[model samples]
Target chain A: MNDQNGLTIAVVGATGAVGQQIIETLMKRDFPYKKLVLLSSARSAGKKVNVGGNELIIQEARPESFDGIDIALFSAGGSVSMELAPEAAKRGAIVIDNTSAFRMDPDVPLVVPEVNEEDVRSHKGIIANPNCSTIQMVVALEPVRKKYGLKKIIVSTYQAVSGAGNAAIEELELETRALIDGKPYEPKVLPVKTGEKHYQIAFNAIPQIDKFEDNGYTFEELKMMNETKKIMHDSNLHVAATCVRLPIETGHSESIYFEIESDDVTADSIKELLKEAPGVVLQDDPANQVYPMPADCVGKKDVFVGRIRKDLDNNKGFHMWVVSDNLQKGAAWNTVQIAESLVNLGVVKKK
Target chain B: MNDQNGLTIAVVGATGAVGQQIIETLMKRDFPYKKLVLLSSARSAGKKVNVGGNELIIQEARPESFDGIDIALFSAGGSVSMELAPEAAKRGAIVIDNTSAFRMDPDVPLVVPEVNEEDVRSHKGIIANPNCSTIQMVVALEPVRKKYGLKKIIVSTYQAVSGAGNAAIEELELETRALIDGKPYEPKVLPVKTGEKHYQIAFNAIPQIDKFEDNGYTFEELKMMNETKKIMHDSNLHVAATCVRLPIETGHSESIYFEIESDDVTADSIKELLKEAPGVVLQDDPANQVYPMPADCVGKKDVFVGRIRKDLDNNKGFHMWVVSDNLQKGAAWNTVQIAESLVNLGVVKKK
Candidate 1:
């Protein structure tokens, strides 16, 4: 670690699923952190977790927890972020939130470094990472939007159980194993954990992701539609999302149909731009049966795009399949990338 | 079975997955039939399957097998249909082919009875069944189309492995069980059974269903796109599809975005129309967390429609989730329905 460049970092929800992935991604990307502070709820306060190499003690996150923290990443649920994010920001740390609490707030800058890097510099002490599904989609379509101008985007998501948190993942596994063994099992944590109803997600697809909104869309779907527009800096962009959860443990796949403003754009030209785009991996060789899948992109840090096709009827429209590890590039990597951008752009305050 | 108003029926691919379901559907629906003749490939000949509590011996399919048959329902592979469908039809039997062979042929009318039962009478000896993914979508959307006049349709399917036949179903189960037990297994029948590559479909989603067509869309995607227009009798309708195979064994779910010509359609009006549409069951109630899911619609005879929503930007556009049993309605029941339409419409030959 370089003491001159490294800054103090605090990770809220250090014991949770996306939280652990954030810690691992920081270590993997060799993120500059002279000192790492791990924080959790009171129930897991004294728990020990291994960092890059050394064991670190988790402390309960509080108003005073961000006393000297330069960068704090929050993945602890929306309520915790609502309660503690302002406290951390007021104490001096620039918070990078992974929940939806501050995302739609006009004061907060929702950032996906590859799609909206400059937005990171405008953050007023807190930068919001876009939703998991939105992050991968924006990463895949930003290049195209920059080249031809995106007019409309309609997406249908095949999301993993892991996006609902670790408990949902365990439920998928236990339910799958039980169903295979011909044993009956009860589902307690799927579709919506807080909602009264739960559905079996193993070997099935549930159309509802989060709670349903009055408009008949799920919160997850709204997050995707809203966050994509914000991150892409296009308020007029037509975006619609149908978010569904599958039994997959990691990686989220989306089938996106987008209409570009230009009439001259072809599928190959879009593929060419994506080939060199930042944070995107082109896995689209349809002749060879090579396309992105959840299992293949589980540990990857880049969004994978494939199945690029020109719409048979609509000349200006095209379709693509985007996939990425929901926990990695979708949350952890995107959050860490934002932190790196802040450090590079001198957005983090000096000690 | 009584001879009065009964027709001798022959089922091609009698030993395969859809063929067995077709036979069962006939009995379940109480179809009029004086005799049942089972025909299969030479490799599957001599196999016996119980039909309506009677053991029917599967016989080798040949030109002579069509003798005295009034109607033949074909569910064998496409090659089998191409070879024997005409042979059966030439002997005065109306061939309801359930393969992709004659679906696009001008001489063969592609039919989804609920959508276009009148198309059944125009069949030149052979009538084609729409693809599983297309069948369910058209069945769900036909009412909307009829009321408002469809303009465009974009569908992304989370299809079941059983659509690929019994081998793919076995592969999903075997691979899932092996993976759950932490054992190794080979995937021989997924993505495409005859393709050069094989991808794991357990705990994953494969974006390619059938083999890739020359134009980047897979064969299955083409089926959904092409067959929708034909069955709906709208050549100018804009249709696009992205087909992906999931580990689900029986039911197929589609996230469909469609546009109608009418400017005055609301989501509620659409729901009301579907509530009264034949062969459709409306399962949309976001408040109570009720929606159409593959697991819930496994053996259902009707297409399940849910999550009806109006597009935020496009007034003419609406989105929905459609689910149906791929083996039941998607294939066998739809095939049997076409047969019943023939009898009801007096399209079948009378003895």
Candidate 2:
């Protein structure tokens, strides 16, 4: 598949959860590459990953590793992205950073393709991926915005532990078994692991997803509020988020209550818009008991929208349930989609 | 402890989940009664309950059983309450109905003592206990309402399976183990088990808590909407709910977004109001990571409120997280409190 547009692609932090999914999504989609480069922290540098039936050795990620790379996918921790993303961009490689380090930066274009693909063209070398929760939400809401014109959004997320990293998933499993065995196990990973106290995430709901900001919104909540505005290019749109971590392992579900600027919008109108919306699957059939659930959304790239209804007594208000695989559309698929968009738009040329 | 108002107090549905909690709550509060009557359906009727060094045999709840009973606490299913509540009321016994039988019936008062205790005095032989989800919400919001006068509410609930029934809990446990062992398990008791096709609750979230109503709100959601109005006595106030079933077994957590009529209401003022409000535990220390979780609230009776914050750019809007043991404040404890209120207010007197 190598041609004039063929280029080397590097995946930073290539062995973690989202990294693994990004590799799978790229291979399954048959992403074109002249050479595949895998980079990770020194601890996982020597690990090998099989991509499209070919084993690629992961090298330690350093600023010098971006030499001759056309596109770099960074899923490493925020600190790594903060230090290496600029370096990779300075090396003539366009960096699609998946960390929060550059997402809120005014110069960094946040791309969701379905919602803001054109934003990628304006990327100043470093493109930022929206938060997983925000990506799924913007995907589900973009069609509505196009049709009905969104004014305000209040979302409460039933998020999965996988969004907290692989350690949180392990903690959920361990705590489930510990609770089943009637053994006293202290929680060490959920509701912000580095915070003062931890709560078991196995069969409980933790209201906190990220560290609490002084305004009482968690950082995760703030990400949804800020990223939605940036990606939608509407700073005047009112957005509020309550990010909660539940026991689910992969898919993240959100209960979104929104008001449209147009009063002519109905629940069926929103459903119809979502039915044809790209990267959105409308599962709202109340008579058939069809609605999106996290378990049903595992491994899926499409954001599922269901339970669509007009708010009682408010002609302008509507509520919808949205679910998407946090690791897929939320992270990996979105990242790969951005790369694909870059190629289709002819933004990046062959090395 | 016997006095001129000494009377027999009967607890219908005394053997089930919330029924047992009601018995325990009564014992802890030292609820006064000259005689205690325990009644249940024929299946649970011959069983016995030991409460505070007293063992009472469960009797079949027939119409004649209300004889000589001055007060009746009904935590039985809706059918049983619909059948037996009127019989108890006709027999001169004040009935505290915990089911959805008469909550919306304009004639019956839906009372949450903290929110609408004044309405308790106007009960015409029957005082309807608000839905479990509604009780916690009204408790959390009543203080805010008393301080700032409420306007609108939008809530999404993460409810426990125990609210469905005892069998749903068993189904969740068995399905969880089956899923872990890579075994196929048919769900028989979740997302409306009586309807066609049961869904798994293990490591999953079900958006439908009850069957769909004509308004597109699930039965559980409607209960919150209707009961909130009745308890808060605000038929003109806007309310919307999205009820969901998570894997958790006991507590019901609500992500509530509300607007107050007054711009003077701050998140800090709401917190101070809740801290001083009766039966409310303010767990709002985000710095210490002290938000409430269902696991910590499994056996407790207090409604936990935390993550309170004012909405940015909206002076009248605020958000809060409300949680409590669904079986407690949501059902049993609220039922017992109604019974206590009947005696304390001298609404029910001995013959």
Candidate 3:
């Protein structure tokens, strides 16, 4: 089927926030797809989604959906990916999953194209996209780490509500409007959608992003800490993260404090390296009041880096601000880039 | 004035946000004032401000305004404090300044009552209130630092717009409403009121809180870093801060990562220490999903601390979430507390 025209691409959970972005990104990139298949739950199976100029119907996602697909992008949920990703892989569809289902698996490779593009080749059957917050941080840090060698990372994220899903985005909008009109609202989707308690994210900051793990760290923070090690392939690198959900709807920003292995490396050298690094745009001109901000990075795909400064007390420590569209670069763009990398590396070819 | 019926209290910048809070705090605390005088700029003079059913006229803050006052709380601006604080002090009024003018002065003490109440006695007529971000953090860290022996601190703040002033509060509300209504708005105030470019703060985070310094850190960030050392009276303590302004209107939240000299300290032990600390509230219960949040901490005077967790990689490192009302504990309450400490310590006296 792939050889008849070109590669066949299937997008699982096509009606979700990230799944929608994946479809848009696939169209925007003009991916060489012989056929594009959209899959969702049975409830949304007949939904019509227009990609560029073509209208396609979303089919119910199942094992048979990947019968003739070459590459499948999954972003619905962890459970959905867990249930159907292997089935798609078994049907010879190279699955680039955007869920946490296979990210930490020993046999799976979690890839951030800018940081670990080569790791995509080693995937057994599934290639996982790193977490939204982790993807931008690693993209900004990879260049610095390659030149100076990273020793420690302490990050605090200012993430958007969109990372929670489209429902969370609606909640933010509705709550904000209600609050503006002097109406009371019962928050039912934030902090964690399925958690016991929900907190308001309208003009408020909730310190917990995902559910808390046994170690007292939220799952989002643990994902950043663990996935940084897995994606960077450096378990010895000390990483600590505090993930918080802000009221923003699109972009995710992070304040990262890192210690380099070399004490003599200055902030200027790190900025210079990031200036030319792939998928990174340096915006660090403090004198002119230039820096990366979430609002400005809403629609862009590049990881924006700025506010680079050496720690006043620690000669080896440096701090930076990194921002990127959580839906784009963090999820959709990275997934599409991974699929592109697979084709470019000849790891997946027309069948 | 000291030999009158009781202490004569004056609140400078009474028309301002923190100033109004100071007047309210004075009334709430029943500071035993013989007379209360509200002072503001000449433009705001003759305005009436009602505090606890007492209608006080706002007078122009001048040297003469403090002639009959025993203690004058100044929150107008740094320039106003710089000019009038010394004049008020010369007229025998103890000026408790809530600006950055005299905070770093070698002769003036920067005080957070919970952390450094005794330092109030060393003030040369003018006692400076620490920055809002610094006050809450020091309040949270003082107990742990005292018991565990502090070495290094790195903090990233989710500060409220009220810390920037009342104008910023209006801007947040305006921008939020405009965005909700799908109307266009040109941000005139945010990040900094007089910044080169204004950015939207509603549903977004601005990395640059104040103007950037020569070293690429914002002035707000520097204030937290420098004021912490001065208030703690430990110049050798390693401190780094990244101060950010969130969309919140009142409370300021901080993600603090600190390294203690004692490697044997556990997060549970730290929580126990803070549970009994002065002007501190312990809300850490991971099982119950309890933690400190900015929205929940508004109107509260205590510094709320929770999410205590020891670092996974470094035994000496610990992370916690600290939050407090920026106006109360950060400014108005702390200023009032300093005045109370002065009177209790016999540094100032009522008739």
Candidate 4:
């Protein structure tokens, strides 16, 4: 579909879980697009997908797939993004890559629109989306950091299996059913599919998300720690994370402990700031037993913040519960938001 | 079966989940008992239970039920323990109450035998068992605190449904099956049974474990914080906890970050210390992908510790993963151990 007077949009890895969500969001939001192209790997290239009544076929994503594309969303693994993102950028498309390929690159701007929409304008063709867990936390924390300067962050994540991709979700279902029926099944994925050993995640929690680095932190944890500094543009801010995969299928939940630069900040003030913060929904009322829960935030695009409280001993410390759909706010929605920001900021022009 | 030379023992709430585990542990450990009596609420009073080929009828627990009983293990709800525990203690029985009714009472000795067995000597007849989550964490941290002189502690728990008792376990199962079958089911028992709203825990994480206090911390979190200080006998130790319940059936997992009083303590040294720590299993081999996981720790007695690493920027801070079966080590085994310790220390005598 080509209007020839509106923005031409392309979605790479369109057959994957996050990719499919990106397409759905674009249609749901009625995004202004002249042409919509869906691209995937060779294995899934020929599949037909129906998006809001339009039948589209997924093409093989290659370097030349970005022709005349004004905005390209890439989620086709790190290697695919590494090969095609820069190519798409060279062909006049603003590449919003969802993989970790260029996120930590000094030249690439890692943008969480709610936290760093301004960084999107400084992008050198390719804008990187933060990790699913990192995106939600930064969105919740940015409002606070802006009001009362952040000094330190300690986060523990209860992430969903969908963050690992489609196969892991299937694995969880199969393993859970097998366990329930007293049948035998093997776990071939989880904690990292290609990693050394496979552990059961049906009714359990695995403390390792991505592979462990030499420094003993998993790559997922390092992403949150390093990306927070990059997106917030704060090198002096102390951040530590322990990322773990739970049996959940969609949303990621985090228990965050943070210290502000000033001691005068109370939990109410933080809640007040977040109540009006863009892309955040405060669900924190303990009296009615209200708090952000992963299952409740499954398809929501906004980060849900709750369980806000001041630390009992530390006057400057606070705790919060953050929950968001790993596929939406964590990946697809943020990617689309960056593109939308590009147009709103007049950085991308319809050709 | 009366041994005639051993102590007369009674198990309260013996028909419930944790109660059954207590009977199993007692039978497995070959506890020295002249006579074994099982007691429950009036509704289940006439039920017969088989423990190690011995059939015993459950009697309604009452003030006079503790007559001639030297040791009474109480795990009925907090209200029941509040009503019956002291009465049993006054009747010459050393009450090892597993409910939270008297845990924080100044007169009741809250004891985790591995961490503070000596506190058992000053029990004032009623020895309170700490919360399941608190019991596992303190067991893991006690050795580290002893060797390194801990200064601060922050923990986030991935707790099991079993901690909420049998109905909650059934709720997790029914809810999970309903969700899997594309059916609708109401959450009646999670986060808190009597609280305002119930959230699904089948494929999600609930941040609120128990009722919220005025300061916004859940009762479960407060129990962990206050109980840690009391068990460690350090009023000055800084401790904070965020307790969340997972869909797990048995084991509870915790991510702990602590700062030692000494800066010279290394991750390797901490691992070395925990390797020989009593009732603590060191499973921190990241190279071979060995760490504590909830599913693997089910039915286990020891607190499994792993993923020990030093914080990147903070020299005094360290992180570790701790897991244990909430029913076994966290409640039943710990309660039985306290009774055994009393005998070993000559505090309990066979009349």
Ten-residue region with minimum lDDT total, candidate 3 chain A:
A1-10
Show what share of the native A-B interface contacts model 3 retains. Answer: 0.86
CAPRI band for model 3: high
CAPRI class of candidate 1: high
lDDT: which is higher, 2 or 4?
4
Relative to the real complex, the DockQ score for model 1 comes to: 0.88
The residue-by-residue lDDT of candidate 2 on A277-310, one tens digit each, is: 9999999888888999999999999999999988
Per-candidate local distance difference test: 0.91, 0.89, 0.90, 0.91
Worst 10 residues of 4 chain B by lDDT: B1-10
Off by over 4 Å in 2: A1-5, B1-5
TM-score of chain A of each: 0.98, 0.97, 0.98, 0.98
- Give each prediction's DockQ, rounded to 2 decimals: 0.88, 0.80, 0.85, 0.85
lDDT of 3: 0.90
| TM-scores, chain B, all models | 0.98, 0.96, 0.98, 0.98
lDDT of 1 by residue, B255-311 (tens): 999999999789999999999999999999999998999899877899999999999
Worst 10 residues of 3 chain B by lDDT: B1-10
Model 1 chain B: lowest-lDDT 10 consecutive positions: B1-10
Name the lDDT value of residue B231 in candidate 1. Answer: 84
Model 2 chain A lowest lDDT segment of ten: A1-10
